[model samples]
Target: MTGDERTTTVGQLPTPDRDRARLPATLTRVVWLLWALSLVVLGLRWWRGEGWELAGVVAVDGLTVVLWAAVTFFGGIVHSYARRYMAGSETIDRFFGRVFAFTLVVLVLVAAESLVLFWLAWLAMGLLMADLIGHVEGWPQARAAGALARRHFLASSALLGVALATLWWETGATTVSGVAATVDGASPLVVLVAAGALVVAAMVQSALLPFHTWLLSSMTAPTPASALMHAGFVNAGGILLVRFAPVVTVEPAVMLAVVLVGAASALGGKLLKTVQTDIKGTLGCSTVGQMGFMLMQAGLGFFAAAITHLILHGFYKAYQFLSSGSRVEHTAPNGTSDGGTTGPVGGAVVVLTAIAGGALFAALTGKGTALDTGLLLAGLVVLTVMHAAREVVRQSDVPAAVRYGAVPLVALPAIAVYATVYGAIEGLLVGLPAVDEHAALTPVHALVGVAFLLTYLAVDTGVYRRSRRLYVALLNAGQPARETLLTDTEDYNEY
Candidate 1:
């Protein structure tokens, strides 16, 4: 902030004038107080162990309680952190206000039972996020980023409207539950359109492929705003899917399409992350990948698993974004030459541990016990465990015996924790129709599964680095708008 604070300048560009900057302590306290109140509501809801409806426009259920708790928890953390982080900046009060408003709108969004409130809340959330993105008043790049984001958000909001309206017209039901209940007998064309619209809306909200540039260019937002967006805001997509699971699950083709979209983004996000040159960009791309997996879980007919991923991802990304500035020391790689690369024996051990991890997950959660989409989920667990176990064995500065033994010791506990959380969330979402809805795995799924595996292997092997075309495509795909980057320095001596 230079010159008059009311018209703070960035490189000689003065934005519209604003009121004097004020401390954000009061707003931060208010958000925390709201979080506390939400927790109290959650406790009462928990004790009651059932949901209620109000005039068919607002519904409070297990999903609502848990989601509200998660939203407010993340909101409280971001607000507290921002109180000190943005204390001295000009326009800090508005930043806090937008953030608070965004949080409240999200609370409204999840509990909304009718199409009108749902759509309105969705649009309001996006507009608030756009304001937060453009909080740096005088930076042209920041303003451009915010506008770009607003366009994408508006598109998402529009699609959501189309989805809800089509469902309403087809089923003659204005409320979410009513739509779900009557959707079975609706025309297939209407179902297809509504489901497609819903999935695309989720993709846009979560920053999936072809709709991710906004997030990539959103570095203009303050780190705290980034944290809030990455942590709680992006999860809107998954929440939308879980809320409308019945609609999307109506057609096998739609579910397959959802799986395909998610796999593409999951793999593409990893590719994009590899090409990133900065910490925030890397984290943003990582969120994209994580969201893809969450959507994939939902498409696989395990809405509980998606919610679990969404909640865990919120906690992780919030911490990653808030603490991104404090990075680890740069040092040479660890471990001996033999341990660095996997030998046959080490590979065998890792693979075995991963399979065992999957089996344990199945036993604990009753998922993947049959030949359905759940089996694919179990495969994902195996893949995840295999990746982690391999890394653990490869990085340990110990003898082969201990390293191999450590795979099961560490991987099994992690799998147990994940299963425990999944079970708990499934319990919380007991009344939801799609909590553990399992469908038969079809040929389309098989094709996608194979492609997903191949993409993973290719990325894991540095194939992108070797193939110039592939690398260039991914690089170009992930780049933000040219205007978002500073190209020249201004010389102030003339002034």
Candidate 2:
């Protein structure tokens, strides 16, 4: 067939038709307004130190306000985008309904003061998202992905329920705030077991490490659904940690475990991210890595930093997924340089810039509220420096002076934004319950920080560029399970 004929045939396949998307589009706008008003009311109540209580079981606080605002805002944006993105899809209305219902559940989960309500909302949110994942009903891939998600979510819900039940039994408190208040006096063994269960639940919900396949498989779903999954629901783990910070922080062993797990998952996800060929796969892995970092921050007793990271990452991921349809042309092919550096000099520049920027940040932020926070700040500095360096390197033909000058111009705003957001979170969450007191820098924390920084720098500098086998393995890691399932299904169908 001629190119024109093929193009016409392809164009006739289901394409977005905005005219038919009116219901979802209108609902999106109305929901956005309602949530905005809810956020304002919640914020005012928090300001007045009279947080609104519902049914004597739910209460809204700063954390609730911030998280609910994120869900509503991003939820609206995703819906609006989906109105066009999923316009011609047969199940577009179902998609919108599921997303709206999921958002509502998440808002309730975050704002729920009662432990029972929180757990129920959490489960409902998961099921709703799973429905969203399988919205393209006839697609086997969607079904498989949704099934995987449901399995993991069900496990998470079970574990969370056990943890909450344990907490209630031990503390005689059924409210989140009440349980947190009673954590200090609870039996050590009970707290430890409950904390461990909660950690596992968070790990599953956040798609950390071995439990991450659901997220990868979920790319088969529509882009809007993928966006919501990554940007909104994936944050549950971080929120869980933040909510129970006081209790978890007190358990040194649990905190240590959290740190180790988070570090492992962060590194694993990042490495796997480097190898993905597809855009959605890469973004999914990126979310996994970002979740690891956020959890790591929480583990390190930087609850405020964790919250900031969660909120910002949510916004960033939503934007990425929404704009991904337009980014196909910009995606770099595998094994190609997208202006990143591999040379020794480039590596040196990256290290030096990281140190200088980290020092400046530490100075401005007063050593960052905790040792881990300082390390996180340093790591972010490295990332910012590397980004700026890549920009300069990519513009190699530009005047040397211009390139050097652009570094500061680029780095300054990033630093400023980081400092501003970190400061704001610290201020906003000051009165939040369950926050552990920030510990001073310790020898162990320092070592972990240094080790993480070195490892990250090595990876960033392309030390693995020559390891083609490893690269290929990492790139294809996400496909095996789905491929196997699909193959088996096809074989069965043929028989």
TM-score winner? 1
RMSD of each: 4.6, 4.6
- What's each prediction's TM-score? 0.90, 0.88
| Residue range 21-104, candidate 2, lDDT tens digits | 777887798779967787787568557855567754888777877777778888888888877777676777778888888888
Off by over 4 Å in 1: 1-23, 328-339, 396-406, 488-495
Say which candidate scores most in lDDT.
Answer: 1
lDDT of each: 0.85, 0.76
The true-versus-predicted C-alpha distance at residue 174 of model 2, in Å, is: 0.9
Give the runs in model 2 whose Cα sits over 4 Å from its true position.
1-22, 42-50, 330-336, 340-352, 369-380, 391-399, 439-444, 483-495
